[model samples]
Target: MTVLVSGGSKCGKSRYAEDIISKSGIDKKYYIATMQPFGEEAHLAIERHRKMREGKGFLTLEQYTDIEKAEISLQSAVLIECMGNLCANEMFSDSAVEDPVSKIVSGIKKLSERAGLLVIVTNEVFSDGIEYESGTMEYIKAMGEINSRISAFADVVTECVYGIPVAVKGDV
Candidate 1:
């Protein structure tokens, strides 16, 4: 089964995704950490997430990009902590990878092929209704497109609002 959990920051989407994946009855749970720590805030957030998953029995795979190449058991359940960071890393990275959407979607498909259950966490973007710079706008557009594509194929699509999950598609 594939699930997409999305919402604003601190909306409890990550916790919800973790809870569902942990109870999935899959013995091998893999947490694919996609965040790339670049600054103090990033480091602190990474530490916080590490602490959260300390006892969750997840073998962490720090794949900032190219998630399809991540090595894991075929029967393992995979939880991709987020798409925002992954997208940013791919878009603004030193590499010459073109079209972040295609790259990410391909990786997701590959992971789905390899894992038993795939749970993806993404942030809700373009909700502020404020004009951003060209580069930022490009990112927002990319995220919106990526989320739409994922939701289309995901078995479950949920929006976490104030720790409450409002189902947008199939049930989790």
Candidate 2:
């Protein structure tokens, strides 16, 4: 089964996803993290997230651009933390790859089919206020599109509010 959990920043999307994965009774769990530590704030954020996942006893695979590599490595259940970052990395890659959304969707479909259960975490960018800058607006628009595509493919879609999950597409 494919699950998609979305929420704002620090809204418990990751924790909720972890709970769902644990409750699924899947023995092998992998946390596919797409974050890259660029500076101090990024490093601290990554470390904090790492600590949270580590406390749950989840085996993590940190990848920046090649999600297919991590997808292929999973033997059982997997939780991909945040698709937005993955999409960003794919679009910003050195190689000129065409149709990044298609590529990402294909890879996600493959992972969903191969894994016993896959839970994807993404931010609901459209829920926020409109962006003032053109670049920011464009990025948000792209993220919104990606979120819609992934949510359509997901068997279960959940939205988190103040650390509580409100089921939007499937059973909670």
Global Cα lDDT for candidate 2 = 0.81
Tens-digit lDDT string for candidate 1 (47-161): 9988988888999999998877889899689999899999998888898377889889878877887888999999998799999999899999999998999888889999999
Among residues 3 or more apart in sequence or in different chains, the pairs in candidate 1 whose N, CA or C atoms overlap within 3 Å are: none
- Backbone clashes in model 1: 0
Off by over 4 Å in 1: none
How much lDDT does each candidate structure score? 0.90, 0.81
List the pairs of residues colliding in candidate 2: none
CA error at residue 1 for candidate 2, angstroms: 0.8
